[model samples]
Every structure is written in structure tokens, then in C-alpha cells.
Target: MMAEKEVQLPILRSVYQDLTRSEQRIADYITSHADEIMDKTIPELARNTKSAEITISRFCKKLGFSGLQGLKIALAAELSSSGDDRFQDIHRGDSYEQVAGKIFGNIAEGMQDTLKILDYAAVERAINALVQARRVAVYGFGNSATVCRDIETRFLRFGMVVQAYDDISQQLTSASLLTAEDVVIAVSHSGSTMNLLKTVEVAKKSGAKIIVITSYAQSNLAKIGDIVLTGMGREVHYRSESVASRLIHMAITDVLYTGIAMQQPEQYQENIGKMRSVISATRE
Candidate 1:
């Protein structure tokens, strides 16, 4: 397996069809006036797009940032690479302060939007699967590969033996040792990562139950897995939510982790209190 830092981030193809009409319009607008919109604050951007702030935040999350700051970083990143201001006019008429509310609005909406389609049953079922697994191999690549790593840590709290493999070879080797006794969870927004798909195929061939978490259940990666959980929507280049996709993914993780913890009520309560204590201490 290649070193973690050496792993390449997959270049995502435009999942444009996955977006709603308004989101598509926003995306088109961004693409058309990339130089102009990059300069606007969240509210200004919202005004230009004729979308609410909430919608804008959700739009940013879809592209994988946590909040507006992240979106700006992405824009800055875009600018750093292109050395051009693509957002000259998108928020041209607005003041920085007026744009802030819409920015918050976009973030608030992104949070709600992600939860709107979350699959509760699948989360429970995944918990049950994890609770029973002898071992698990989590997979994804590029931007999503780390989420698999994050999920691995979540499984560890329940005391399940887990491994997250991003390399094609390591994942294949891990699959060779599995049986129906194990579970494999794969995450990809596009569900088309070749490395991810290959390992999933290997695990399936080895009689393991495969679970796929992605944005599109209709994707090939979702089809191969025995169970699929979807958590994605339209792309509007909104940049309001900053990083809503990770928030949504984190929420899904939160639910799955809670469901697993709840399976043992006493442990769940104890763990919750302990967790709260730690968090409370951090508040100081």
C-alpha cells in the first residue's frame, strides 16, 4: 500500500445531474461568472443567484466544505491555482456585512438539507452489521478515503476489529481473508472510484457483506454492495455551508455510532456521560 500522504485525491467528475434545478442554475451561474461570484459574501452571492442563504450553504456543503470559510478557502484555492478573480460581479452590489446573514442562512439550510434524506433504517442496519462483524475493511479514495478512516475509529469504540485500506493492493489482500463473517463499508460521493469498486468486488467474491455509503444509491458502487446509504444532493457552487458534505457525512456517522452504542444501553449511557465530561472540560 502507498503511504497515506501519497494517495491521490480523485478528481470528481461533475455530478451535475444529482443537483436540483435551483442548484443547477447556481452552478451554471458560478461557472459562467466564476471571476465575479468569487468576490461576493454569502448574502451577495445569494442575491445574485436568487437563492436563500440556507440554500447557498447547502450548496457549498455538497462540494465538501464545513462552512463558508472553507468555501472561501476553496475559492481562494481556485484563485491560487488560476490567479484570477472569478467572482467580480456575483455579489458586486452588496456590502460585506449584509452578506453575512445569508452566509449563516446557507449554513443552517445545508445542515437541514443533509438530514432531510438521511437513511435511519440503513444506519441501524449498519450498526447491527458492525456489532456482529469479526472484522471490517473500510474503503474510499481521494476526498472520501479519510472518511472511511474516520468511520473505522467510530467502529473501534464498539470494540470491533476494523481496518481501513485505501490502497488497491492492501484492500484486495484484506478481502482475501474475509468471509460472510465480515463487513465492508465503502464510501464515495460518486460511487465510481475504481480502487474502491475493485476491493468491494473482491470482498463480495469472498462472501462478505458489503455496505456502500455514497451520494447516489443508483451508482454502480451502491449496486454492488448488499446495503447502501446515500447522503448527497445538488451542487450549486454556493459555498455557503462552507463544508456541508462532511457535516452530512459526519451526521450519518453520528447516527451509526449512536445506534451501535445504543445496542448496549448501559455502555451507551456510560460512554455518553464520559464523552460529555470530556467535551465539557474542553469548554474551559
Candidate 2:
């Protein structure tokens, strides 16, 4: 299947809270009147939003566009793209089967969207960092903590020295100790979690590589990321705060794990065999 064209509306939505007052005003106008954006020139947009042309241009650049024209092009592409919203809301008195189908369908579409936006080069950089790092640390809180633990579980099988931290203090402490030879995988769905951002900032100052797995490519955490893996999972009415994004993040973890294994097949195989034997013995 062909990948969908890159969409910018979601990026605006994700970063809306982080934008400055003037930028937010521009975003509000563009997002609310997306269909009319193409027909208007830069001056018209600026005048309509009650902002200067330069402010609008700056806003576009902040969202990773070159200028207003680039933003318009992206808006046009998104407007013309063909796709229906797959995430259905869970209404009261809905049948069990109907609810099940809706949930499953949304998750499937979310994954598909992730695959479409998944940057292979970024994935390769992350895998290389993980493989070569003297130590690896993962940071996540709330829903993202599960993905962090999954990272630890998968990398440990490959005999990699990795730890996952869910607590803010622990995350900060771990970040402070990381060296140039270390890597940090920071997971966040919103990508704007203040505590996680602070921890990642510490990790950044320690000269360790930061690999951010988040849905927002332009988030503050992503700005600090040496390698950014973007996932596209929209917040639906039923699944508030990106509950669906956790699964998408976990899928990314699996991709990284498989890639790391491929880099050294025989060594990974040997480690897997040893780990499986010891764990099997413990289970029974």
C-alpha cells in the first residue's frame, strides 16, 4: 500500500499549546479556515489574523515549514488527501461487538499512519546508537512507561546494558550519569511532558544521544532529539490523551529490537538462546 502524504494539521494541533500567542493566533486561523487558506495570499492571511506578515512567516518556520507558501502547499496536500477518520467514538448503549470493532479499527489505522510516517533513516540511526552505546537508558511516564519497559525487555535479550525509568527523580538521576557513549530513548505521546523534557535536557547536556519516539515531530523533546521517530496517532473522543499512541510506540520498539538483532544475527541468537533457557527454567 502507498504511504499517505505528510499532513501538517495534526502537527499544528500537537504544538498549539507550545506556540507563542501570535503563533497560536495564526494556527487558529489556518486550522479553522483550512479550506480557505489556499485562496488567500500571505498579506491576506496576515491581515485576517491581525498579525504581521513576518510573524506569520516565523510561525510557519517554527512548524518546520520554510514560509507561508510551504505551509500552504502542505495544507493543500492535506486538504486534497483522500481518507476518512477511522477512529469511531464509543457511544452509550453501543453493542460489545461494535465497541470492539471501533477500538480495533482505530488502532489498526493508527499503526498504518505510523508506518506511513516512520522514517527509516531515523530508525537506522537509533538502532546504531543502541548497538554501539556503552549504556542505554529509557525514560517515560504514565502511558509511555509501558513502552519504556518494553524497550528494556527487548534490548536486554540482546545482552545490551539498558534500564527503563518511570519515576521523574530516577530518570533525572540516570540522565545525569550518562556519558558520550550512552544513549537515551525518551518516549512520550504528547512530547511536551515537562518532567520528561527536563530529564531529557539533562541527558542532552551529558553528551549522550537522545532518541525520541513521539507522535509530535516538532515538540520540545523532539527538538532535543538526536534521532526523532514520529508516530501518527490522533486523540479520539473515546481514547483521550493518546491511549492509542502507546501501542504505536511499542510497535516502534519492536522495530528497533529487530533491527538491532539483525545487525549481529549470530550474537543475538546466542544471547536469546541463553536468556530463554534461564527464563524457562525459572518459569516452571
How far out, in Å, is residue 178 in model 2? 2.0
Candidate 2 residues 1-284, lDDT tens each? 55433334755755676788988888878866776787888899899999999898888888778987888886776666625554477887889998888888878877766775677999999999899999999999998998999899888888888999999999999999999999999999888899999999999999999999998877889998999998856566766646788988999989999999999999998998998898899999
- Tens-place lDDT per residue, model 1, 90-208, is 16466777456555444454444455445567777888888888888888776677788888877776657887888888988998889999999887877877878888898899999
Candidate 2 minimal-lDDT segment of 10 residues? 1-10
What TM-score should be assigned to candidate 2?
A: 0.82
Model 1 regions more than 4 Å off = 1-104, 233-243, 268-284
The local lDDT score (0 to 100) that residue 26 gets in candidate 1 is 68
Worst 10 residues of 1 by lDDT: 4-13
Angstrom error of the Cα, residue 203, model 1: value is 0.9
lDDT value, residue 211 of candidate 2:
97
